[model samples]
Target: MHPTVSGSGRLMLGFQYFLHFSVMGIVLPYFNLYCFHIGLTGFEIGAVSALRSAALVLFSLVWSILADRYSARKPIYILCIFISTGIWSLYLFTVDFWMILAITLIYGIFYSPVISFLEAFTMDALGVEKTRYGSIRVWGSVSFIAVVILIGKIIDLYRIDVILVLVLLGASLQSMASFKIPEVKRSRKHQAFLFPITLFRKEVIVFLGCAFLMLASHGAYYGFFSIHLESLGYTKTFIGFTWALASLSEIGVMIRSRTLFKNYSLHTVLVFSFMMAALRWGCLIFFRSAFTILLSQCLHSITYGAFHMSSILYMDALTPDDAKTVGQAANNAVTYGLGLMTGFFMAGALYEPIGAKGLFAISGIIALLAGAIFQTMGKRIKVFPP
Candidate 1:
């Protein structure tokens, strides 16, 4: 493997995450719009959107297993990312529903692992000081906000097709930058067999379950918010600006998280986050005022921002010191890989009949469940300091 991430490498790894997920934010928000721009109806749009989640379910484990077995982190990230980017590139010419569906499926299988492996790569390179992970991760949010507002303005003047081209270019840049990241291998002893269930302990299982619910709560906003705005007669430019407003809040939390998480346990941060999600989404359910929409979006900081940092910290604290690599992979497998897929699939059907208000009500309840579980049972966790 190339020389491990010295201090210099950590900064580069951060930039890579920023670049990679930024591409994700740019494309994901507009994907449903693209489907509608074609002939697809609402149902088709949800299904197409969920395809990325489906892809994660199909491939996250297989890729993680490969990364662990051979200790080949960088190559796996590079290859899978390249495949996903190439598939994304084809969207410019092809708008057929079946063809689009096929591309989504391929993207799923190849795409989910990039972030998992990359995050695992980050932890391996950074070592024990887990606080910095958020500081780096926030850059992805920053890039996302920047791209969303810019693309929004662009789309208002030009055709939506510009998104396809920009997304392809961003994905390609991430793939290229990934090449410079140092390799991370499962240490020799972990190379031997170990129980996978070790990942599913009291604190961990709760955190994962909570993370799943918290993400599920996002289904309405992520999949349906643009449509909601469209219905409300907001222009594409305004919608994009609103979306960026949320990420801008998220960036603030991420920048402050190292200090916040350091003083407060990860559980403290998580409990507060889930509570905020409930309040934010609940308000969305009852209130349609623009101020409420803007207010709720700002809370993305607590709903997504703080909870994500806490989840990473919780993962580091819970995993056996020997199993750090596996721990990171398991987080992706449960939270993003499986949990996210489950949420998106359900949201596709639910959002159509229920509408945003009903959809968000359920989101509030789910976030409450997540919070209750974390607050009551999380105290019993063994690995975390009391």
Candidate 2:
């Protein structure tokens, strides 16, 4: 493993995450609300979201391959940020469904690689002591909470259109932050270690499949949680607080993730996360009170925080150094891209017929299935030790 990165370098990396996810926390939680404000229906919103996921799936592999092949990540990382900033600005001028769809696709091309490449760069910077990844990544959760709460209040006082400005500002700052990450030098020795076909082994496939199901089950929450609250007569400020609560819980989990990794196998953590996800969604189906919803949101710690951190560590342990980027990309492609695409599409279809409660109940079932799949892996899968 390469020497542990200098303390300043680690801080810069953490700052980059803080900036990037700050943009995401603003955009991801509220984009559907923006669509609603603009007169788009649930189905129309779903179609737009699915297009974005499609772009992620289509381009994530291409970008990750390019990054891995050239042994370069920083340039692509910076390019993606600048380009996303430009594309997001176009939102100010367009509102037609088709036009919005086209822009989302274009945006996806540049945006898809952001997280996957960053994960690869971060893991590389941290080397074999990968547990420290959570320490740095938790900064993202902190920033996300700040952005969501602040923006929610702004939107409450002003209008949803202001989100475009916030998104643009976040993207601009993210581009600047990207410059602080030092370039990762690629060695010729590692260049030949491309993504291997053997990665499709049954255990790995099961892992990816379970990850996909877990993420897919989150479709209702990600795509429509804000709108659902709004329809229930909750204020935008309250909605934002609920979203911030999830990130707050996520922050607690990430802060302790290294210790969690120290005591449990990645497989064990994943199973626990999936189970918690199931319970969280189930609670969302039956509960509408503020207290219950806030309590349910706390499970975000297990559902996304622990699950995501565990998945990264698992991929790092399972993949060769040279193929790490590709591994991370594949994880993004399957779970975030394909899984999210499926979830949003289905939620759109089922939402009108079944309503939010039914949608969440279905999500609970899918989470249970995901946990079942992971259970089947059992001792066949290798566990990462402290």
* Candidate 2 TM-score to native: 0.97
lDDT of 1 by residue, 1-386 (tens): 22245777877887887898678667767878767778787667777767777667557766766666666657778899889989887777798988888888888888878777777676667566667777778878988888888888989999988888888889888888877887554454543143365555566777777787777777767777787788788888888888888889988788887788768877788899989989998987766667777877898888878887777767767765455556666777676656666566666777778776777788789889889988898777764644
lDDT of 2 by residue, 270-307 (tens): 99999999999999888889999999999998899999
What TM-score does candidate 1 get on C-alpha atoms?
0.92
Backbone clash total for model 2 is 0
Candidate 2 whole-model C-alpha lDDT, 0 to 1: 0.86
Candidate 2 runs further than 4 Å off: 189-193, 196-198, 384-386
User: Residue 358 in model 2: shift from native, Å?
Assistant: 1.1
Lowest-lDDT window of 10 residues in candidate 2?
Answer: 189-198
Any idea how many clashes model 1 has? 1
**TM values, all candidates:** 0.92, 0.97
Q: lDDT scores for all predictions? A: 0.75, 0.86
Please name the candidate that would achieve the greatest lDDT relative to the true structure: 2
Error of 1 at 158 (Å): 1.2
